[model samples]
Target chain A: MSTLETAAQPEYLCRIAIDPLSRVEGHGKVTLFTDRDHHIRQARLHIVEFRGFEKFIQGRPYWEVPVVVQRLCGICPVSHNLAASKAVDQLVGAHEITPTAEKIRRLMHYGQTLQSHAVHFFHLASPDFLFEFDAEVARRNIGGVMADYPDVARQGVRLRKYGQEVIRVTAGKRVHGTGNVPGGVNKALTLQERNYLLADLDLMIQWGRNIVKLIKQAYALNPGYFSDFATIRSNYLSLVRADGALDLYHGGLRTKNDQGQILFDHLDYRRYAQVLREQVKPWSYMKFPFINSLGPDRGWYRVGPLARINNCDFIPTPLAEDERREFAALGEGQPVHLTLAYHWARMIELLHAAEAIHELLLDPDIFGDELVVRGEMAREGVGVIEAPRGTLFHHYRINEDGLIEKANLIVSTTNNNQAMNESIRQVAERYLDGKELTEPLLNQIEVAVRAYDPCLSCATHALGQMPLYVELVEAETGTVMDCLVRDADGTFRHSG
Target chain B: MSEEQSFTLDGRRVPFQAGQTIMAAALAAGVYIPHLCFNREFAPHGSCRVCLVGVNGRMQAACTTPAAAGQTVESETGEIREIRRGILQMLFVEGNHVCPACEKSGACQLQAVAYYVGMLAPHYTHFYPRRPVDASHPEAVIDFNRCILCELCVRASRDVDGKNVFAVQGRGIEAHLVVNTPSGKLGATDFSIHDKAAQVCPTGAILTKHRGYEIPIGQRLYDRKPISVVGDVATLSESKGGRRHD
Candidate 1:
């Protein structure tokens, strides 16, 4: 792996970079600048890849957008598929889909949320929480979790596989399934497919409860540190049902300030442009989105499990709601700003997804025959959903010929851009400020970023690339003092 | 009539009728020859040379080359398969054929033929040519980027539909399929979704509107069986009385 030029400014006497962040969905770099006394001055997370899916998807037929946009990210393609499908439904003038179609889509979304959060908590983020943050790199991964905690590791794999099976039965494949169409879905759940998913429903729910308990126990081991680690105060945004229930598939927009005060509720998502605006910076490829009323600096907020859990009134499911009550008490009736609490909140959603899947499986609507509905055509449409990562938006304008003239997508990871940077800066200040650069210190920065479970590929719209590099350099002579590279295969080594 | 005409293909004797191409004779005798852009319903176009085989020490397109008495045609040979793979690769790079997101992924003739011939990857830099998509038609959409100059639709519209609604324009790399309409859009023409032209495309270029991925990937035509086993979609549609299972 070749090292690029250090992105250090001349104002700082030293620079440290964590390039090609490991265990994240896509490629990104974190650069920290320090003064002569090794006091870290500034930290920035840089998205180095560029993907222009919005531009390329401009001329495609409106109906193809749901399937074609799945190319954005392999991890959360179902989210993109459903989001684009919802937008296409509006383009076809089907403001509301049929009952069967709605149920099928909800099942697919919950399956996606279940699988995605399972992978993040069990496979990606568990290694850090189960092991010491400064543990050796070799033993700080899923393999190590398997070696030490076999049951936890086995359940994680099974839970993830079960979620994938749910996707397969509903959408037709584990990845890039083609179940959703413009106005509705193309197929309904069959008896065999339903039975296949039902056989594992109870076990998945049981495992879901077990994993949630696992994360809570892990958090309890070091409450003070885990609660304070990478913690920050920022606004939260998500979607909630009209009755103030947490709705992952569809709902009106909601946002809350750092103090848990509602900034907006039941706001029509179609008018999102009236409230949200994106800011582009030269340093990073990911766009910074902020509330239109608050401006860039303070308006920038957090999205994903923590934000969704904090912004919503209650999770509709019984078990997750009980967990939510306990989690809410941690904040003392305010929003929980702890970054590591994200994993705990994420587990709650996983259980909710399991319970939701159980409920949908028992409902006969999923097996109904009326799967599609259509109406008069429209020129413009917008779709918004609470993806596993956070709020995802897909908007499009089509010509009279039904060809897409323009497209704009604000993915879940893009919604967390500024908040991720802030968390990284906070971690850098607390862990590495006025200290010698070490591998453990660098891992702390990554731990903070991974708390958000950022899919950099989705944020940058890139594909087939994730290589991270970390470099510590002397700013005076522009000489590299230390360098570390993490290849795409998740192997790391020291280099010049 | 005396002894039937025959040819030796890959060491197997293939019986043929009078005035039949090598490809026709092979398919008639239940033998598989990898091909694209050649259909049994229409006269052999022989444009996509994926059916190249060694005929008496000469490389020839099986769809256009005639079968003769005792002629030896060597197919499935390593060298011939390599050339076929190269031709398939060029066809892939020449057009923006993104199979993953394509609506006709599993059932597309081009994709099936590529798989049959073991064309693993594009094996060449993609041209990524910018092309236009005409979705004006009420029943169909035409994505010109995926057109491989196969001329199947051009022939189907002109001969079967008798409308002459489709034609090929330009030359060489610039050659493209066009709707023969005053507005140059499929909606402006008298083309119907039932036209043979709509079902004859070997790629995702010409697709029926609002009906994509109706058959799941694993259950689609080529997904269940190889193109060599199930035959091309056009011939299968014809055999099924003009109704496509895909």
Candidate 2:
């Protein structure tokens, strides 16, 4: 009977596509191919948009780069701004900025990281964790979370707002503030700004602790499922202080294996090209960056909050350090490979950011009048920082006229491109393989992608454009069986 | 002075001294005509045409058109405003006036004049011409991209600094500011940061190095008040001891 049934039907491959991924910063799509039995064959995360900020920034004056690069990501403009400013610092030959300048930039960065991580968790990722994966689409959103858990919703809003206030006081405006210049900062923290931030520092720190606890509880609700969902064993990369503590603003590059074995440590980011090579694929506009030693297949690694948490020996702050200890134990003294753990790790870092902000606020040097420093000029400079999502690199070369001759930027999301694809594949195989497709099942793939908090806009270097579409196709005849497009306006349409 | 010569400007009588242009007379009477290339300290170049107004039924640059007793000038009329807005828009598209990234954004006279004339956007296609930034100067940087060919720096260098450090070389769209030095670099020229040419640029063309965003955005020269109330950078520099311009 089985042989007769097999001979009666033709086995053909089918494809499922999720385009213009929602709840992410920019446009991305996922495509999965399966056989007649719905056994997953191939999975790909495609970055469709392209923005050549690196190309257009060429020929601009080097001094304007910090401000110009801020156009890369509105959510993390301060990260780009500070990274470019650090590169420009080398151009101006001020390899070491004044203590006050360093502290001021650190304060700004902490504020940015705090706000960005807050936004990603509370606004984008919380809906998935707070509700069942199979919950109705409308009920598995931020609006649903707000309606059901008003206290959680209110805390998230206040947390993000507090972080923005920190940025406004340190940077100037909460968005594209001109806080950092070539050699140093543009402005010092005023007494009024300092006092205003200080008034809320304790409350923000407490809120940060509360949010971390909230994510912990969310993870505990389904530890077995959460720990294994889209889990993959891969290398992690981030920046760590000279003493092996996590330092978001300034640090040397560090990479570790899945088993928590250090691959490289204390490597100067200026030598990044020596160890890293970006491989381009025809399918996606985003480049796949991998460790040169490992090559593309095994060289590709994870970044951002999870990677930072995994790669660092310890977070310096007391509250975050304790949380880190608990989080690390999840792997039994090894790196946590759970993708959903990104939220837990992100909350820990958010607490660290709040603590860092508190420390910097008390430092008297932040208000010093000596804001800028200068020296002989250099022709080339490279800057790297641990941005909210992951590591960010800004490299530039200038001509004799002080015009930018060339620029290369490897943003955080770009670094995790391969990891994101791998995570999507893992989830697609586990949840989508051999199963009837549904809206909830499709969201599983997105849940994995969102674990990285991927900023497709930042990765693609594109402006405001994000739309997702999904398509199912038959491989034998190359016919699309079903199609779903989520327009840029957030409206969805289903058609064949 | 003898009986002051006066002109009826936008229905207001503006008194003028002998040999003063309508723009100078109107400015002296606390009235703003939304100009770019005209400065009180220099001979009216009348090149930008931003201050164009109807004079007795004919359009003329207020800076070059001499004021006369009982002469009627129309500056605040809808037709005159539209013309001014067009001129401002043209000036914007002609150069790379990225105000958000410009150091002189709030203090820039061209931006102020554009705002005073209600220019909401650059209405024409932008001519994103490649321009060089002369940053070799230790104290000053000249971004040629922001230059509108107003010749204020050229005139200021020649008339006030007594050094012919800058000049406009090309004609029409090809016209651009060039340093008088053989190297064609601002650093190679005998131009000091203190030179009047350094402070006379209507845009971010000529800016002092290491002083960008010094005063922050909200507290800059034009941020606190409209150009109509505070006048241009030159007037503020002259009256307020250059405190506001920088």
Candidate 3:
């Protein structure tokens, strides 16, 4: 009986959860568990809500879906509009689209990425850099940046406003733009509109350069600043054009392992099951999208900033490439294994996108005519675009009557399941000493998770408005942890 | 419809769809109907009678009129045009709409449609009422003096947003948009100019608070283009500030 009793036993199950994780576009949570050796046993990331846009879009006309989907997120509405319209265009299968329309479409995509990426950094990510992560939530906003370095804040606003103007001039509205269509863009950019944008664009060019310099100066001043977050190497994925350029809208998929070896390139999307697998866990609503051949039990992969940096063959823009090379110098390796390095990588991508935009605007077709695709709506198709967070995949199957029959939205956050899980574990393993956890350190882990800007509400719950409230419960006693909250300026603010 | 319909709008016989509004059928039939508050953007609320059409009997909002498949729809007739003019006259009379001084004058949907229907003179006495202007939002303005009470903003806030940031408080003509989220300003609430509900005003009621002088009048909406210009707009993020609130 004593011999039969001998067995491998489970040890401590460390559970962690952070509701309303800071630094992300929307609300989210991260949970992880570990044994006594600090070995990660399990990790789950739950984005607990969905607005059911796909189901609601059932009977609405296809053209209206882009506009409706644009309302899904105030942060990156134009990206949704572009992806939806592109999907509708593919289904229509019109080959008659003129070059001028293509020019406008590319310009719009550039404009959307420009504004969204700008907001992602200037408005969202910079807070952690400018203010202490442990600082009071009330004072850790744009005002925080203003108080510490007003010049940076002012420059950010100038840069951000300039990028948004491109959207305003072309999309008519920035957030919920609708000027794009399946056949082509709705209108041509007038000479006058172009001139209006040119002045601000000139200002942005100066500001963008200054931003790179500031980041470089900060890095030089603190050489070891990145070592703390480095070494989170995971299999990375991104979209690159036929020439392996960093293409935002039109591109084929590129997936690579941590060794910088090209595992796959331009794989047909219809056979996506061959490359990706979703392992559903009971703890989290989000599905773990592991590299299919990587095996099921073998988990942990990263996406968004870190993944994009790892997967890319080379930086496209000249200036961005230099900065990217400098970034690689911090950790001399093929795939830098640092999660914190994601911020620097993201800034490089932003610089690249801005430079590419200026080049695209110079194309003569952008100012020409020939819009609209001639076709009847009676087909189904897919449109994949790069959201500010990651690659956003939208698949729709419409009926002959031109109504949506089914919709599958694999958003930016959904694609990076393995990566996020790995990042959480890595952070936990590194930060959580063999000691009781403090509130601020836990929140730092939360901020680290949200650097991807995962829009979980857009990921799941495709039926109605998703409302998720994460509560802290006492494990044995089943008592609620007191969460003190007060209404501050019509929004919930917490002070302990 | 099973019902045989024939209608003469501007001396043309147009078959009207059963249960379809006169404006809806006319729009489907390629007739250019002018209206300020009536946008297909939302279901017809009938707050603006700019789409006033002469039915078989009395004047009606073409957007709200039901075409019974057999009904005659007089859309472009002189009498209907004259009614539209009077509605504009009353709309202008009820508020302070100084076109020469207004920012939305050239690009304003109201002024453009009014010009299309020939509302040359107000032909009515001005109300000369003093209304509150909310300049609380650093990026948007709510000028009650320029509001036409078309309920576009109200409906946008209540119906679309599911957030009642804006409401028509008080009774009768005294009804005005009340901001219940403190300080009577949009910025005070979770509201920002980016919300669809906030920026969809038909008249000069709610105006873009910033970047007015950035783009000259010659390049603004309607003055240089049409609503169909939706496809031509480019998406540029460099110079924009994301809405103050997500």
Candidate 4:
């Protein structure tokens, strides 16, 4: 989006809207500002679009939402898809899906986390560690990382590729493939696909070793590179399974305040709004989220890396345990409040996920019989699976005629609205140095902002918003400079 | 409540759960609804109106309308009656519903539905769109011209399917199923009929080649009788209050 002209000294405002950020699954944007003191005054995330999938599907059939929304994020489709599918299964009162099928889906969910994390570490954030943060602007890139440590880059690429490959064989196509369904999968995998997946599983072993080495090296060489010029922290949150296992794709909400104390854990999904509430600010369209009890300013619990690491009890995979310990060491153990520690946390999850995927392949019925449980058409249901970004819930109210009358969707990214805003504000306040304002600083802010891997598209959604209004305010006078209801992507239009 | 006005199939009474449609009760009882567009998650959109049946004295579309109390629905009516005949004819005339030569013939729900309604001719003039066939997925195929705008495929895509891959474009009779992506193809977008939403299609509009005939015609759905009879044989735990039995 183009910046509006301000008569008063243009307090450098960078509005970065990246639709379908390359190497990432969904669309989102980052905004930061430098005040008169040149000190960063404000940073906001504008999620203008909304699939309104939640409202759009008020009465839509239950099973379809998972598949439909799974594609919403090409990167982490299965998690949201399964979460929604599971929620739908609960809604209609259908029998639980086969243990094997559910296990396969869980395995797939881990694959999603693995692939998404590798993408962030290798392609998204590697440039900073490879070329020191203080290094020349142009020198920072995948090329820079490869120039010094080719093996790290290669391993990262291979690990991510293995994750995508796992999705391909079990689900069919690599990105948002078929095979997952409410009752069960459409078709069981063939022996060939199964064997191929197991063989491919070995690649992550070598790749995971490289991941540890790289993270350790980055910490040792330039610990400050991972340091927070943007000193900030927020309450962390995540989901856990019934057995108290770390639930990536299936779990209720759990949260911890910045003080490193568990605030809430194992809250039922139906009452998610009771704990997490939306807070939309006038400056930006993106809705800020907070613990409902505390309200807006007081509630700022973060989801994703910070949340998952703080909330999860034990890392299922052994390799990931050491990485987690190393991360805890950064912020002095217990509940690490340092936001940059998200990088380390994300890596540990990736390492753990790779192992989970391997374990899933070993299940005898991974491609065995019982793909679907045949059913009558009149059943109503809700599916609640976790998207890579956050918790995704799909609720369907099917009419006797079996038509969709209403649909309610609560996606994962939206689950972190409040924490996202607070994180942005803290980062902006800390990093926006007054004197020398360069674009690289702004870009790094965007990248660091993305370290959380926000899914604004999934959060803002689509088709749900008919007309999105963009109101520009003059920072000096604090007056409404101009209010235009721009079409969702920030293209100002006279008409809706 | 004493006699219960009970109905049983093979000594087992369907629960006939309240709010539960005959289809759901039947499926719960292991009975199947021969529907193409009806998926579990999405709200039913009964545009194709193929799932028409007689409830009590009136006729209604199974997917859109409700299954009320003390209702008896006929899946197969003698002579393929006006509503079923009209639905079949319109379905035939709407798309390139050319059977026999088409791969989905024999196993197709349109053909099966047409057979159930005893449809022999396309009474209305054919207004076929010279639409291209989209066989994009290395596995799946999409032939627009041969499609019967049943919207089950469309509904499946949006509601149950989730991807919203298929959409109804062009108004009125001019409407045809268009792929939501740039290429206007299923493969281009994330779609595979392998799922219930995609595979639930009834007509030749969305067919899976190998799975068919593989089950044999005599044993195939609707061939033994209508879905109502097959559906009736499966319902269990008959509801004491008025419930739907197709």
Among all candidates shown, the one with the greatest DockQ: 1
Question: lDDT by residue for model 2 over B51-157, one digit each (tens)?
Answer: 89999999999999999889999989999899989988988888889987776777788888888889989999998888877788888888888988889989999
- The residue-by-residue lDDT of candidate 4 on A313-411, one tens digit each, is 666767776666666666665577655666767777777787787777777777666655534443445555555565566656655433356765656
Return whichever of 1 and 3 wins on DockQ.
1
- How high is each candidate's TM-score? 0.94, 0.92, 0.64, 0.61
Each candidate's fnat: 0.39, 0.32, 0.00, 0.00
State the TM-score of candidate 4 restricted to chain B: 0.68
The CAPRI-style docking tier of model 2 reads acceptable
Give the lowest summed-lDDT range of ten residues in model 1 chain A. Answer: A1-10
Task: Quote the lDDT for A251 in model 1.
Answer: 92
Q: How many residue pairs clash in each candidate?
A: 5, 8, 41, 64
lDDT of 2 by residue, A359-414 (tens): 99889998898888999999999999999989999999998877799999999999
lDDT of 3 by residue, B117-158 (tens): 778889998898877666566656677878877777767777
Instruction: Write out the backbone clash pairs for model 2.
Output: A17-A470, A19-A468, A19-A469, A20-A467, A20-A468, A20-A469, A38-A434, A304-A389
Per-residue alpha-carbon lDDT of candidate 3 for residues A34-84, written as tens digits (9 for 90 to 100)? 444544445456676656777766643454466667777776677787777
True contact recovery of candidate 4: 0.00
Model 4, B25: alpha-carbon shift in Å?
A: 46
User: Comparing chain B with the reference, what is the TM-score for each candidate?
Assistant: 0.94, 0.94, 0.81, 0.68
Error of 4 at A430 (Å): 2.0
